[model samples]
Target: MTNNKKRQRVPHHPTSTLYSADTSRSESSLKLCRLTSNSSFNDNSTADVILRLYVDSSSPFVWDSTAEDEVQIYLHSDLLHRSKYFAALLSDRWQNPVSNINGINSDNDKKFIRLNFDVSSPTPSSISDHMTVLQLLYTDDFSSVINSVTVALDLLPVALKLLFEDCVKACVKFIEAVPWTEEEEKRVIEIIPLIREEQSRELLSRLYAPDDSCEEMLNGLIMSAIHNHPNTASVKAFVAKLLREFASRESARRVLERAFEESLKVVKESLEEYSSPDFRGDTCETEAIQRLNLHTAMTNGRHLVWLVERMIELRVADSAVKEWIEQAEFTVNLQRTFRDDAWRNIVPGLPSVVMRCTCKLANGVAGGTILATRQVRMKLVKDWLPVLIVCKDNVSPLVPSQKALYLDLEETFLRIISTLPMSDAQELLQQCLSFSTKNLEDCPHLIRAFNTWFRRATQPSLTGDHC
Candidate 1:
């Protein structure tokens, strides 16, 4: 779009009589006296119509929180045409305009129309100053509307309510420009329900969205949206897209790691109290569950699974896997208290499935007579073995209750070897054995399980070896 189009899109608010005054006069001279309980506008000689704005007197706009303290402004009735809201109020034939008129006071021969503005704000600071709202109402000065994020947010609904499209656009523009920190994102998400227009909602959603250049920013937006709207399927699907993008970008690997790190921190804090010196585990279960809010835990567990699966696929680094395993250890204790499907699937089922698939692939290569097949198998196993080993070593201690998890992984390992020709199976077993022996002495159960599978599988291979 050209500058003229941009200029046309954002309505300009020029100087007007209500706010702007002679440079020689001080600003205080232009300041309208804040109305008090007994104050009434004498519209007789000065203006054609006295438009009274009755906000929550408690709102700073009225100086005091009382019904009689309505802010009164004098303006020509034709000015209502500038605002669609006011125009409709006066022109709507079916609506009872007379009912809206509280009373008419004829002062100094001018007609005064009294109407309640009813601005909603529970506290004084919650809404914008009455004078600023009035200035925007009558004049075209919108520069102050976008001055601050808080002001912009507060003004948006008012702008929409008063049919101030220009101010609404300006607010949207301001929101787009400002950096939406996590807290601000949450605030924006919460207020989404209050915005009535589809255009405005889409604009706000776009503001929350990150551009393609920053994967982490997009990740953060998705996380925030998912956090706020956990049940929304669209938000969850967006998360999957973000994960795929994160996997492809080598630079985003650290960003992905950091996001998981922050999520794990929440998990850590929730479980930390249980490990405290003073607390006995018996009574702490209920308190712990409350602190580890079920919704958040489930979301994080799903996130954990998503991150781990991507990390494994991208082959970024084993450290992320290790960190996740460490976090999963705390979750093990929860199995005794809560047997959630998502938690179980992530904690053990997924990892077990991964190993099973890897084992099957290695087994296929072993039975292949072709040299290329065997070479491909060797490279695949060489790259995958350490990751499998780390998971096996770390998770075994973490989830001891799930004994079958280790058994399945061990059995899968043996199945791969058994399918291999005797020599190939033996060599693969030796590679695993060496790694386990060096790094995983403490995981005796896994070693023993591996040894048992190896022995059982190897015996048959040995007997048929030369046959």
Candidate 2:
């Protein structure tokens, strides 16, 4: 086809001018400029091919009319043949006889090809992209041109369409080596399918991830934040926020549960060893190892407290509550260790650290952050209450925070106690007498517990009261 041949106009802007200058100036600007610095490209006198590009207003590729809708460029068939798309067009089968019409004689010396920007696909920068790729065919240094991901993305689709191997390779190489913004990553994904499979391999790797990869990564972060990181406070806080904002609550629950179990295991084993050392014959070595065990237990107890807090915050503490309730042996070992004078000098914060785990879990159950069943609630307080009493009795000269923790926990235990059967409450409440102070007003939680119990105990039976 030729530029002068009659064709259907674009529907959206049928009469849109290629250029808006007056007729005299528009005629001169029709030949926009030569596109290449190559000596052969600059000399149109010997050029045998004319390339015409025009946008159809109805075409999806057309965007706002910031540039001219049509353009004509002078070209040499040899350099234009670098693109496989143009090489096919310039071959013998496509050539047609020159014809005369409108009393204008055809320029038999030059071959004419009209390239249309209209296509099934759409892109706002299609015209500029094609123009740039065509300009690149005559140049060797592609790095200077395809410098950024945006520029590479713009030129890549056009290069692939033209089957221009060099430009395609250049675009892909630049993209592979550079980092992308979030938006640029989206663009790279969009263009991946249009390129050859081998060409797209590196880009695919950048975006590819195994199934459940997100959960795996979150699990690692949670473990590192809780166990491996030296800066525990800030990292743990950040990880806690991540768990809260994670899309899958069940996955976060699973990750937190795994971490909680691991930390609990370490704390349990350490306390167990400290309470009943598997003595070697050397007394001094055994004592040193026992001190190390207490320190390990205390350190892991702090980690357990953090993990419990996160589980409660996410409402995924059901399993943790059950597990904590079932640790009757662990609690026993902890009580035995706390009763000794040895741990006071080795790990002064051990009692408070251990009780914080119990306190947070109990508070969660009491406050409804974690919805434990009646049985789980009962066993939780039953197993850990003795540990609390032991710490209160044995760890003296309590810091303000430790005293506050014990007070808060005593109240939480009392609150949980009120939820059980009177028989069960009666059994548990009697253990809470140690919570009372010389001044009864100071132990309101204790006072309220007994008051509520007596109030329920004295109520007339429903079966007999109905008459």
Which candidate has the highest lDDT of all?
Answer: 2
- Candidate 2 lDDT tens digits, 1-467: 36652233222221222222124322423333334544333244554454555667765555664555565554566777789987776575344423211222234554444344442237655555665676676666676567678888877888898899999999999999999999999999999999989999999988998878888999899888877899988998899889889999999888888888888898888888776747433589898988788888888888888888888888898899899988889989988888888888899998888788888989988999888898998898888889999999998988899999999999999999999999999999999889988997889989889999999999988987777
Score every model by TM-score.
Answer: 0.38, 0.85
Candidate 1 per-residue lDDT over residues 143-251, each given as its tens digit: 5344666666666666767786666776767876777767767766766666656645665666556555566565676567446675756775666576666545665
* Runs of candidate 1 exceeding 4 Å displacement: 1-45, 51-70, 92-100, 126-130, 190-467
Q: Candidate 2, which ten residues in sequence have the lowest lDDT sum?
A: 10-19
lDDT of 2 at 442: 84
**Number of clashing pairs per prediction, in order:** 2, 0
Superposition-based RMSD of candidate 2 using all C-alpha atoms, in angstroms: 6.2
Q: Model 2 TM-score?
A: 0.85
